[model samples]
Target: MEEFFKKYKIELEKEELEKFEKFLEIFKQKNSQINLSAIRDDNGIIEKHFVDSVMLNIFLDFLEIENPKVADLGTGGGFPLIPLAIVNPEVNFVGIDSVGKKLKAIDEFVEELELKNVKTLNGRAEEIGQNL
Candidate 1:
């Protein structure tokens, strides 16, 4: 994890690190009620969700997009969207999920993290993308 942060120092933020941890906790609690994610284990969440999500910063940097608008298609439980939003507060992030329960979890997570540039929509990306 330290290596991951060191590799992408410019995009990572201290506040985002804190929010990522909080997001993990919230996912754990919400998992009991709804099947938001298939990976219910802590290690899985940390690796597949948290780490993978944060890694998007590297992609953004590679693209040389200073303030790109990102859409996380089928962003179940806010994977690769919430963490990316936290790390790159300057960028806009929109999470799309058809599951109401999952969207609810994402809304709660976004509110808890006090994110301003992140939005959650309860629908499929295929349907939304056509309108865009």
Candidate 2:
């Protein structure tokens, strides 16, 4: 778990980390309610979803982002966005999704975890990205 902590240490507070633990539990419970996640089991969620999402940090420095305004287009199930927010609080993050159910799920997750630096928008990326 040290590696996990090291990876996410910049963003997650002790309380947020604790909340993440609880969020996982709640996600598991609520996931059944909404089918928000494909990875049903805990190991799958941890390995495939969580770890995989956290790994995006490897690209930021390589991509030479001092600070960037990132948009996670079509961020269904909050994949790279949620975990990315947990790993790099300094980076400005926005998650855009067209699915209302998915956005609701993400809103609950964001609220429960109290992730301050992340925001979600319900719209098509093409429509909004053009405006930006």
Task: Determine the C-alpha RMSD for candidate 1 after optimal superposition of all C-alphas.
Answer: 2.6
For 23-93, candidate 1 gives per-residue lDDT tens digits of 87888888877887889987778777777778766678888876689988888878888878887888998
Question: Model 2, range 53-116, lDDT digits (tens) per residue?
Answer: 7778778757877778778999988888887887677888999999989888888888887788
> Estimated TM-score per prediction?
0.84, 0.83
Which candidate number would show the highest lDDT if scored against the true structure? Answer: 1
Q: Least lDDT summed over 10 consecutive residues: which range in candidate 1?
A: 1-10
Q: What TM-score does prediction 1 earn?
A: 0.84
TM-score of model number 2: 0.83
